[model samples]
Each structure stands twice: as C-alpha cells, then as structure tokens.
Target: MAFIERYSRRTRWFHAGIYVAVLVLLATGWWLALGREGRPSPLARVTGLADTTVHLWTGWGLAGLAGVAVTVGVRAAGTFLVESVRFRRGDLRWFVRWPAAVWTGRFASHDGHFDPGQRVANLVLTGCLAVLIGSGVGLAFIDGGIGFVVLRQIHRWATFALTPVVVGHIVIASGILPGYRGVARSMHGGRLRVETAKRVWPGWLHRTQNR
Candidate 1:
C-alpha cells in the first residue's frame, strides 16, 4: 500500500474549526430554544456562561470562520467550489450505483475532484450555512419585534433541514460506512492510501499524479 497527501494541514485545521463552531452553535442554540434561554445548559455550565450567550458567540465565530475561508483560504475555497460544481459525463451513472456502492466498495467510474453526491452536499451545506449565519446576524441586531421572530423561525427551519445532511456527511466521513473506509483519514490525517484514492476519487488521483 502507498500513501499520498490529500488535504493540507491548513485545510484540515480550517475544517476542524468550522465544524467545531457549528456543533457548538447547534447544541447551544437548541438548548436556548427549548425554553432554557437564560439558564445554563451543559455547555454553558462548562463555560460559566448562559446558553443564549454561548449560542450567539458560537454563531458569530462560525461566521468568522467563513470569512477567513474566503479571505485567507481563498484559493483553496475557490478550488473546492470549482471542483464541486462541475459535472462530467459519468456523474449521473455514478449516482445510479452509489446506493449499493456505499456498502459494496465498488464505486462507479467517474471523473472529477469530488463525487456527484459530494457536489450536491457542498451546495446544500453552503446554502444552509449562509442562511444560518445571515439569519443569526439579523437576530443579533433586531430584538423584540416581527423581524426577530421571522429570523428565529428561519434559523430554526434551516437547522432542521441541515441536521440530517450533516449527519450523513459525518457517517461517511467517519469511515463508518463500508465503502467509505479510510476516507476519514483524508481529512483527519491529510493523506490517503493509493488504492483508497483510486476507489473513491480516481480522477482526482489521476490528476494529481499527472500534475
């Protein structure tokens, strides 16, 4: 078995930061929403702050992470955006076999950086994050009015919609799924076994070797 670098250490750190902020925000947000607004939830208890305070601060921190991604990691962010949105000839075919592929470890042949499923996931996750941040910022400024009410509801619904997709992403990225074995290392360890690269992202591996 051979190993090759995938994500950079910087990229992995950014990924870690964004997800940590998001998870913290989600936990605190729910705690506050469930009628524990000023009370100390487990997180708040640990931090010695109120639930609402933790939720608000974490949301802003997430927004800050996004800003850094676009500004500091702009090139990487651009590459990811480009690779994720572009479609190729075999993409549709890849989707057809994906369900079975998840367990069978026999992914359909496709050419691209990210798989078709990942492309869809990227768009959905990005959109939801935008909504969550925007609504959260709005909620920060406007208090005790219809605008606040509307933003709260939008934030709630966006959270509702995003949770399942995030879970699926975690399941795959955790390498818990049969076909995604070793994939978690691409992010966590910033490398992949050559065979795992071929099975999961043939085009990306080929492109890397040729480059």
Candidate 2:
C-alpha cells in the first residue's frame, strides 16, 4: 500500500500551465482558421479579444513559460529530458505488448523513468510544440509576404497533426483504459499505490527507488 513520489510541485505547475496555454492556442487557432478572420467563437468571446490576437499572445506566453521552465526549473527539465531520451533493453517488447496491456492490467517492464511509449510521446509532443511555437511567432511578427503565408500554413498543419496525438495522450494519461486505471494520480504531485505503480511502471518504480 506504499506510495512513491512522482511529479514535483514545480513540475506539475509547469505542466498544467503549458497544457492550458496550448489548449487555448489550439481553440483560438482552429476557430479563426475555420471561420472568417473577423469572426470569433465563444472561446474568443470569453477572452474579449480577436481570435488571432488571442492566439498570438498565448503563443508568446507559452514561449516565455518554456523559457522560464528551462531557466528556473532547470533540474526538473534536465531530469525530464534525460528520462525521455533514454531507451533501454525490453523497450521494444514493451511496445509490442502495449495493445493487449491496454485492457489486461499487465504492462511489460523496461528501464528508465519513461516507458517506451512515453518516450515516443515526449519526443513527438516536443516536436509539435516547437513547430507550433516557431510558426506561430513567425506568423505573428511577419506581415504581408509569402513567408507569413507559409508560416500560417505550417501552423495549420502542425495543429492538425498535434490534435489527435494530444487527444491520445490525454486518454492514456487519464487512466480511463482498464490497464491504466489508478495510474492518473501519478501526475501533479500525486502518487500511486505500490502495486498499481509496479504494474503500470515497474521499471520507473525500480529506478526511482534504486536511485
């Protein structure tokens, strides 16, 4: 029945802030893209700003937040980077067994803080976010040129690509799947029962304890 420490307060705060910003950006960006430039959704109504304005400011804010995280929460950022980059033996087996594990409450063991799937998720989400931020900034700063048009198109496609991946990540992290039940609490300074932790992330638990 023992529990292990998972996310730190700072880590959790940054995580929540970043995701909230991304969600806001997505809503505004998609609304503007689908509607006329002057038209805005209720999400835009609440913000009391034009959709493009909201999206632009939010993107800048996210970039600043990321900078702050890297500077102020350097330790946590480093740990996350190290963990996400790590790949170890048995990782391939973990991915191969992931489908059945989704409903079986049994996950294959592998090394490191992140499972193989999570490492892939980390890389993908990072790439998408980088593309989003880069293109968003370019679109916001540049005006009336082919470059701006190109950036806008890139941002559009990046949003299209990121949406489903983010949704899937949400589904998994929410622990709605049978195999991941009780796993949701591991984020945001929460913990999991020893058994639940072991079942879902045996390698992480082992590494955390041993380290």
Candidate 3:
C-alpha cells in the first residue's frame, strides 16, 4: 500500500515557484551576459531581451516566496535552515554512516535529520544565492550607470557559480541517490509512504502525518 501523505500545499508551491523562477533567471541572465560582444548564439538572440528588469523581478519574486515560506512554517523551516547544522561528535559519525545505513535499509532509524550531503549543498547554494542576489541588485544599478565595478564582478562570478551547483545537484539527486523513488513520489504525489517513512524521514514522520 502506498501512503498518500505529501507536502503541505504551501511548501509544494514555494518549491515549485522557486524552481521555475531560478531556471528563468538563469536562462535570461545567461543570454544577456553571453550575447554581448557580437556573440551570435541563437539562444542569445532569443533570451538576450531579458535585461536587468526581468532578472530583478524574478529574483524579487523568489525572495518574496522565501519570505512567505519563512512565515508559513517558521519553526520547521528555521530548524532546517539555521539549527540543522551538525556540530556534535556523533553527528559526524551519523553523517558518515548514513549512506551505508541507507544501502542496508537501516536509515529509517537514524535519529539525526537533514542528511549531511543535503546540508552541504543547501549551505553552498544558499550562500551563492545570497551573493548572487546582492551583487545582482548592484548589477542592475550598474547597468543603469550607478553601481561599482567590484560589485559587477562579484555578480558575474556568483551567476557563473549557479550553473555548476545546479547541474551537480540535479545529477546527484536523480542519479546517485538510492531513494530516488521516494524522492520522486515526494515531489509528484506530494506525500511519502509511511512504510518507507523511516528512511525518508529519519527524525519525524508521524508528527507531520498527524499535523
């Protein structure tokens, strides 16, 4: 039997919105950046029209969604974002053991939440995005003939960083992760199977189910 539990509507929508916005921003930003200097790439022509205004609007939209998300599930999201860091002694042990546990079907009982790999990615991505947004705002002003060269350079690098991080995330999540099926179900169906609940959620499943 498949457990029909899924993400809350708020969480699902937040994730979906960010996913789309990020892709658009990347595509458009790439066009504007690469299409300069008489570059003749076809996609550049297609996306080159997306200027700082387009980038700013989409980025602000994403930031707005994040603001809403923080308010919607303050405690849960806060824990996942801020307090989820594993600084303790055995925390490191569990991080190393998690994969083996997952391989042998023992991940269900693991107490620590937010897998080590995910935390690392989240930290990197979050930091990169902050820099990207900060410098991007500067870029917009600079494009308008007001911002600094250093800010523009930082924005450029931050934008470039996004590509590799996103590509690696997709590849590793879809290719290497053992619980691909459950991950898909989580996104597709919005909920997870209670049977696989342990592996899917090492910390708390029943609490969410009841909520």
- lDDT digits (tens) for residues 97-194 of candidate 1: 99999999899987888888988998889889999999999999996789989999999999988888888899998989989899999999887999
Each model's C-alpha lDDT? 0.88, 0.83, 0.64
lDDT: worst 10-residue window of model 2: 188-197
Candidate 3: tens digits of C-alpha lDDT, residues 102-155: 455454233444555666777777778778777766665564443577886776
lDDT of 3: 0.64
TM-score of each: 0.95, 0.93, 0.72
Off by over 4 Å in 3: 2-6, 35-48, 51-54, 67-77, 97-109, 144-147, 172-176, 206-211
Tell me the lDDT of model 3 at 18.
75
Best by TM-score: 1
* Steric overlap count per candidate: 0, 0, 5
Clashes of 1: 0
- Screening candidate 2 with a backbone cut-off below 3 angstroms (N, C-alpha, C), the clashing residue pairs are none
Question: Please, what are the lDDT tens digits per residue for candidate 2 over residues 38-123?
Answer: 87678778878887788888889999987886798788778887889888776888989999999997778876677788888888
